[model samples]
Target: MGALMSVAPEPGWPEPEWHRPPVGGYTADDLDRLPNLPPHTELIDGSLILVSPQTAFHMRAMRLLENRLLEAAPPELDVAREMTVTLGPRDRPEPDVLVVKGEAEPRQTTFQPEDVILAIEVVSAESEARDRNVKPRKYAEAGIRHFWRVEEDKGLPVVYVFELEPATKTYVVSGIYHEQLKVPVPFPIKIDLTAINRRQP
Candidate 1:
């Protein structure tokens, strides 16, 4: 019993290496098999990235947008949140919101790129770069027809919508919207940004 007291508390946990890649780095399928992974873990360019905790604005905005999209979506389309799309062997990213074609299986955890018509990212301070640039490029490369990145401005959402240019396999800025997001592609969608995070009786 005395010996136990003699041991000092361990140093601040060293930089986590368990999520580090092996000889050739991680793969998309590895995400599904990895044990004890934090929820919403993403594989980006063969590196496992545990995303930052979402802000209150993020959660409310995401829910509001998802609900609105669901209301406006066509019968054949479905809206999902925080679901991964396996873009390639080295890339599987979970978007904040997705508009996917057809019905998903009960046990489906990942979707194929071809099935996703729109992937939306709600930008958080920590995820600005990835949300604005990295994700769009990958989504476009996989031929996803549309993408949206939402930014917070004084507690309101400002949406930037993009469309894939097949000739270059790149994304072209479709529009930047504030207050109201109205779009015609990938089926019509209109949202009132001010409604996000509003208190309801």
Candidate 2:
């Protein structure tokens, strides 16, 4: 007698009868199983999205910003990289950089925008749209008080600082830093736009 072959079920488990191709989505589990991703990819809207690769100048500016921010960071502040923030099932995004007030381990949940003191995104050609539109709304909806978009491609970061406007339920631009401007954060640090410009690729 011939052995019976077992057939695998279709991709979508619960609704096997519902015929539809998986419309590309990822769960937190999917993100966990991925092997190390290159720095240029970020997880957004439950899928891995490719961002523009950083250039030498971009890296230099990032390093400078990191150094300045780190030096003046409050003891309560925790600076991190490519960390995921759960913004509903369709809106989880891994920001390039974040400043938060508490440890991540014990919490186990991704950073809530309210938990984050600030969010900074370094925009390259590929990431310009999301950095400008999607992320700002995601952070704002999550109640993040401040956000910064750093445009490295322009040879200088056009910093956009947004603060939540309670009455309006939206973030209002508090400051825009093009050249030399002091950030309104409690701890003071000078972001040298000239230095950022000098390092542009």
**Which portions of model 2 miss their true places by more than 4 Å?**
1-24, 35-40, 106-110, 197-201
Candidate with the greatest lDDT versus the true structure: 1
Model 1: CA > 4 A from native: 1-17, 199-201
Q: lDDT scores for all predictions?
A: 0.83, 0.64
Candidate 2 Cα deviation (angstroms), residue 96:
2.1
lDDT string, candidate 2, 1-201, tens digits: 001112345578553221221376655444444554434344556555644445765566566666667767888887776677766665557676778886678636367667788787776565567878878887888787777777753566667777777766577887888776586564575777777545332
- Score residue 76 of candidate 1 by CA lDDT: 95
- Write model 1 residue lDDT over 85-132, tens digit each, in one string: 999999888999999999899989999999998999998877777888
- Whole-model lDDT for model 2 versus the true structure? 0.64
Assess candidate 1 and give its lDDT: 0.83
RMSD of each: 7.2, 9.6
